[model samples]
Target: MSHSQPDTISAALARGRLGISSVVSFVIAAAAPLTVVAGGATTGYAVTGVTGIPLAYLVVAVVLALFAVGYVAMSRRIINAGAFYTYVSRGLGRPAGAGAAMVALLAYNAMQIGLYGGAGAVLAQFLDGYGVDAPWWVWALVAWAVVAVLGVLRIDLNGRVLAVVLIAECVVALVFDAVMVSHPADGGVSFDTLAPSHVFAAGIGAALVTAITGFVGFEGTVVFSEETRDPRRTIAWATYIALAVTGLLYGFSAWAMSVATGPDRIVEAARADGTDLIFTLVSPHLTDSVITVARVLFITSLFAALLSFHHTVARYLFALGRERVLPPAFGRTSRRTGAPKIGSLVQSGLAAAVLIAYALAEADPIVHLFFWVTVTGGLGVLILMTLTSVAVVGFFARIVHAEGLWRSTIAPNVAAVALGGILAITLGEFDTLLGVAPDSPLRWAFPASYGVAGLLGIVWALILRATRPHVYDAIGLGADRDTTALRTPDLVRHPA
Candidate 1:
């Protein structure tokens, strides 16, 4: 319990620095409501020719809510910034946890770096209007610089930045939705896209996977648990609040787009306007200045997501370092800011390297970099969620706990099955998600990368077991004091 213990002082994040609102802001910013509505939803309609995106978001939200029942229940017992990695380690085994850790790093890095392609493209297009012509990578590097700086500063300061941007983004989205809904096509609103029949029709698999991508960052709630004020309550409230706000925003905005353009024409409009579909729908009703503001908010939305994911990836590294799974250097936090300095720098470096490589290759920033990479990241997360659900059942079954059967067992079992099904569908439609021919190697390559990463992690974990059993045993134990306390029966106990 001593605050000055070398181990605790070395590995601890800034304790009790975040409250519910701050945590919720981080989660929502990562979801990037404006970016998703403007880019993801439109892309889903255009690419899949599916009009049921609104219903898809609602269904994914419900599935995630089921997943959270056990997720938050486990968070109450195990506090770690490693989140999925830590949970899998404790609930499953050290080897699985190690594999989960590698997969998480790959997934989050892909998500974070992919945004630069998006932010860069969006910003470059926005600037072209003002006669400021530049390559997309130039703007991407600008965003990368800003996020790198923010990544090493105080965590709460980053939260404040996200909160400001998220509020404006949500307000603009709702206003746009209202304008679109009020001026429905042919003076009549259509509820066709919201119907179950449309949602369950052919191509529904791709639509559901696209919707799941929009909800990617909500699982990040427990990632900040160790640093939150009253984590047990704050984590749960933030998780649900994030899911509700994002679900409603995405579904409403998508449906409004359908209402603005008749459901029949929604696919055509998305194909024509691409990411600008939402802006184009409202532009005829609003002034040029207001449209400009909305466009700028769209760019900021991408930046906010970059910063949020940067923090998540850095913390995962910090957790791994603290457990000696990687190197102890990763565990060290800045004395002044309590930030994961080494980990943050490492993530920034990786992002910069990827951006440069893509620029050198002359890849299309939006298509090859943004859409393809981020969707692949979403797939990795989907796999992790499925595994974590099974881990929850395993963890609770072995330990003594006060949770009911529903929270401890039933919900997780249901979630595992649900997520596993979605994972299968997503894999089956991976080529569709990437807009590639079914026989293209890119489809298999991206998903296969995670498999390789997971296998490498397992091999490393087994090596650690044989050579460094002490480090292996301490796998998911989190920070220094928590590790000591958790080893005792009073903190967490197993059946005799």
Candidate 2:
């Protein structure tokens, strides 16, 4: 391929097809509000033994918003689909950045594969209602096929589908909240759930971590910056919009559920009906039709989440490949669709392999595949966020930006400290979160794997620096080369 031809292919990502709203839609869909409210809220109540789950969501929102201060600040100056990988490289150097890149790939891929488990389990349940019998992995494979198709299409098309699902998810959640408020139980719409003492009471650490998990996709807004219109403003606005919308929706629904069950009895109620808590509460206030619709939407919620993560993971792989950190072929884009076709296929294949492995092993899809993988994925993401926060401070500290102190220094440092604390708490309480024995191998394996992956990335980066200086220079393509050009550092060495 000629140099310009390769550069043209590298830069192809269906640019200008997405705006702020589209970016928000993708991020919000990734969060999957309906799934969180239906299942996650119940888990939060059971684990925390507190009525202040809403307050926990608010706390996480605030912490992440602070993190976004520096994140968006950097996004404006450095545009790349690599996200944390690119940010860390520019701020922390190529080796550390490469480590972050590998960790991100693991974190996002885990989340995507984990969603397949959840989707398959839920689809089987839906099918069971109609007397259609099949293994959960069968349903999982079907959804995997759908996501693979969408992942290789133009992103704007995917954004449209996600927007529809996201809007429906929000509507159902809001209606449920309204029903709870109108039919408040003995507690009568109490404000006690918002109390600091209540929020920080027993099991607060677990509650806070779960709440943090709910906001995972907010920071992902910048991943689409390359395709978005007016990226600087669009990325910033989308971040704030996604965070505020997700926080309010989650907080309102959780607090309302507590009121529906009576604050003091919410934990017991959630324990009795863990997965069906939301449906159970809503069914009483609405007609049977509403219940059926909610059930169908619940499955769609999982599908939307799976699809959203599929695109994110594909882009991460594409960015790494473009940098020559992975096989160069993985960087190839489709000329017609301007999609990262190879990366998308790779992600789909990986998901298929994992699904097949779980099926052959006869693993419990929900527990072993969904719960175990997502919790581990969430931990990896938290670690990545923490590192990115540190990189933000490092990046800005050395540069001669005229930005304010808060965005450049204080907010990133504070976010780093806050995330570090959360990461520690999560590790300490890992077994509790996974409902496993204290000595379980899973308790150690997940965190250890991420550590090993990061180390390997660092080692590979060092080797590249020593033996392939040209490739090393292109690791992140530096700040001078417009990331939009999509040319990797190694591309310079093999110019046609």
Candidate 3:
């Protein structure tokens, strides 16, 4: 853990790309297709029954909106590339901070690599219906290659591409939802769908889980906190606006889907259509050309989402390296592109390793690799959010004018409590969540990951303290630390 500062960490502050705007920022944040394919309303209906799903969206949106209060409040104060980890480090201490950062890297990397399986399956089905035969992994590898290119490219270019895919697909989704509202289908547009009665229905916890996933890539906007026009204003506004906009899109679309099909029947329909039921439901509702366009948008959205996740992983690595936890090289951004080149390569290598392992095992990419990995990402994110909430409390503990204790401190704190309970339920229901048996491999893989990451982090901290106190001092604490190794009071924390 103790190595002299490598040349990489000493590099000048990155004038990161201004590639992202509030518009594109929001799109990439909200419109990731994998989560939506579970269908916009799918979570609502399944969790609270068709009736309660909309309410779940309202509930999560409002609750997390509370969390965003602290998130944005802190962002205005402290702007940095590292998201939750940075905030935790500032408030909680460097060791906890380093632990969170490395684990987040593990979690997000799992998500990006998981996308390959999902992309492969979707592409395979698209081709198979036309008799252009190939296994899902072929398409998955093709996707992996394309996203790898996007990940290493300059940030502006990547933003533009993501904006296009997200906008087009999201617009198509909205148009169909509009149609569904007017069409009088079972789950379509009824006031009853939004009722509180439905919110408390059968699978409320499950619905909350699904709704939360769509919000996954949203936090990533802060990954480019250093590169944005005004880190303070840009980062805070993006988080709030993105969450508000994404919440509306997801909630409204769910309501519309219910209206398109009767609420009672939408579940049965989804059983047949699966997550893509909304896409297929509206296929016959739209012209052939429009259907093709939506289909194409679907694939590209998946790719854009993958690249978004990939960049997040790189940033996490960059944060760790910059902080001197991992090799300092991971902290380095390419002088040429202003992207985290070293970290990007390391992330891609790890992903390639996982993909190869899955391929070698003849595993079902979507079922095994994608599903398991994404779930791990889900768990990790939940944990980060919870810990980060505690960090928020610690942060406001020292602030003079309590501008948003309720939003940042109380609300998010409450959300974190709810999230903890949900995560516990998720752990217990892993078998049900993954549609596997009690003794399924997934049972071991899921919870085992949490334990493994925790142990490694604890060990790393001990090693740093014993062998590399200097580096350990920098672990969760920021460079804002004086030589005394405590973060300066004026230093701001990032929200998760």
Q: Which residue pairs show backbone clashes in model 1?
A: none
The candidate 1 region of ten consecutive residues with least summed lDDT is: 487-496
lDDT of 1 by residue, 338-402 (tens): 89888999999999999999999999998788888888888889989999999999898887779
Query: What does the lDDT read for residue 123 in candidate 1?
Result: 96
Q: State the TM-score for model 2.
A: 0.93
Model 3 spans > 4 angstroms off: 1-13, 19-53, 129-131, 186-193, 399-404, 438-441, 477-487, 491-496
lDDT by candidate, in order shown: 0.90, 0.82, 0.67
What are the models' TM-scores?
A: 0.96, 0.93, 0.88
Sorted on lDDT, best first, the list reads 1, 2, 3
Q: What is the lDDT of residue 158 in candidate 1?
A: 88
Off by over 4 Å in 1: 1-9, 480-483, 489-496
Q: Could you tell me the C-alpha RMSD of candidate 3 in Å?
A: 3.9
Report clashes for each candidate as comma-separated counts.
0, 1, 22
Tens-place lDDT digits, model 2, residues 62-101: 8898999999998887778889988888788889988998
